[model samples]
Target: MKKIEAYIRHEAFEPIRLELLELGFPSLTISEVKGSGRQKGITERYRGAELTNWLRPKVKLECVVASGDVQTVVDAILKHARTGSIGDGKVFVLPVEEAYRIRTGESGEETLQAHPGVAQAAS
Candidate 1:
């Protein structure tokens, strides 16, 4: 199994999410985060005062998928998240040993698949 972590611009979240669902990989965890990358940070005027080195608001998306589905998921994210600008964000893939669904007692890849016995494609 693999875990996909993507840090994307806040504005790109909805499109990426819709694309993921369309690709039949819907299980995901999202968080609102503030971070900076190569661009470091951006400056903004607040009450006539310039604020420098401020962390930008970003959306952190996390999902676990079968090893075979890693590239597909990554591609979907990239397709929907690009904005032809800096701070487009980054995607990271890591090995996931296992996953278990507490309520259903489903484990391994099953834990990442859709519930209600619906076998989703690319899961």
Candidate 2:
């Protein structure tokens, strides 16, 4: 198992989600986040004043999938999130030792398949 985490531009979240769904990856997590990368934030105006170094709003996406699905999930994110500009975001993949479904007390691959209509990683 693997966990894929991505920090992406706020506006790109919807497109990324849709693409992931189309790829049969429907179980995921999303959160509103604030950070800066090489762009190092940007300047904005507020109440007739210039605000510098303001954090940029981003969307953080997390998904745990079977090992074979990692590449497909990563590709979907990249395809939908790229905007040909700085602050586009980054993706990270990490090891997942185990997974379980709380509702049904299912473990491992069974837990993943526990969700209706959700595709499980091919073991």
Candidate 3:
């Protein structure tokens, strides 16, 4: 198993999410975050005062998938998250030692698949 963490623009969330779901990766986590990269930050005028935000707003998307599905999930994120510009964000794939479903006490890959009834209810 592997954990994929992607930092993406706020506007890119919906599309990337839909793409992931369409690709059968419906179970994932998201968080509102602020970060800085090559694009630096932004400067704007507020009340006629120059204000610079060192950390830009971002969306952090995380999901654990089977090792075999790593590349596919990464590709989907890239396809939907890219804006052809700096601050497009980053994606990191890491090794996952193990995973367990708290509700069923199921471990390994079985815990990664979305439950059929839950998937249906989500739709």
Clashes of each: 0, 0, 0
How displaced is residue 70 in candidate 3, in Å?
0.5
* CA lDDT, every model vs. true structure: 0.86, 0.83, 0.91
TM per candidate comes to 0.86, 0.86, 0.92
Model 3 TM: 0.92
**Candidate 2: tens digits of C-alpha lDDT, residues 31-114:** 999887786857889999998975788899999998988999899899989988888999999999989888778778665543
Candidate 2 residue-wise lDDT at 56: 84
The numbered model that scores best in lDDT is 3
Residue pairs with backbone overlap in model 2: none
Residue 6 displacement in candidate 3 (angstroms): 0.2
Q: Rank the candidates by lDDT, best first.
A: 3, 1, 2
- Candidate 1 residue-wise lDDT, 33-98, digit = tens: 988777577788999999897588889999999999999999999988888888899999999987
Model 3: per-residue lDDT, tens digit, 1-123?
999999999999998888777778898899999988898868999999999898999999999999999999999999989989999999999999999899989999999997666545555
Query: Which runs of model 1 end up more than 4 angstroms from their true locations?
Result: 116-123
Instruction: lDDT for model 1, please.
Output: 0.86
